[model samples]
Target: MYTKLKDELLVEAYEHAVRSQLDGEFLQILKEELDRRGIIFDEAKKVATADNNKS
Candidate 1:
């Protein structure tokens, strides 16, 4: 399902999840899928990780 999504939508979804501070599981799944597809969101990952640590 994730793979079927357009590249722009995938990145948009990831960015939204990070901005929304989604739960670890949700973010993890997205992150993993993105990584598997070789999509690098280094800054977003850093921000998401930092936010997760706050919870």
Candidate 2:
């Protein structure tokens, strides 16, 4: 749940950042953070699937 919330916030922040025309460095940071969060979400899903299989 927290991850999902964070993802939503990141999306909003990204859009805002784009609209407001933030510096290149800040935009890159947000993009990298979003990408990292996506990897975390994918790993969580894989773990959940493996746990489900054990049951």
lDDT of each: 0.70, 0.65
Error of 2 at 48 (Å): 16
- Give lDDT tens digits, candidate 2, residues 1-55: 3545455577678769999999989999988976765523343333122334469
The 10 consecutive residues of candidate 1 with the worst lDDT sum are 44-53
Best by TM-score: 1
Worst 10 residues of 2 by lDDT: 39-48
Error of 1 at 6 (Å): 1.2
Candidate 2 Cα misplacement greater than 4 A, ranges: 1-5, 39-55
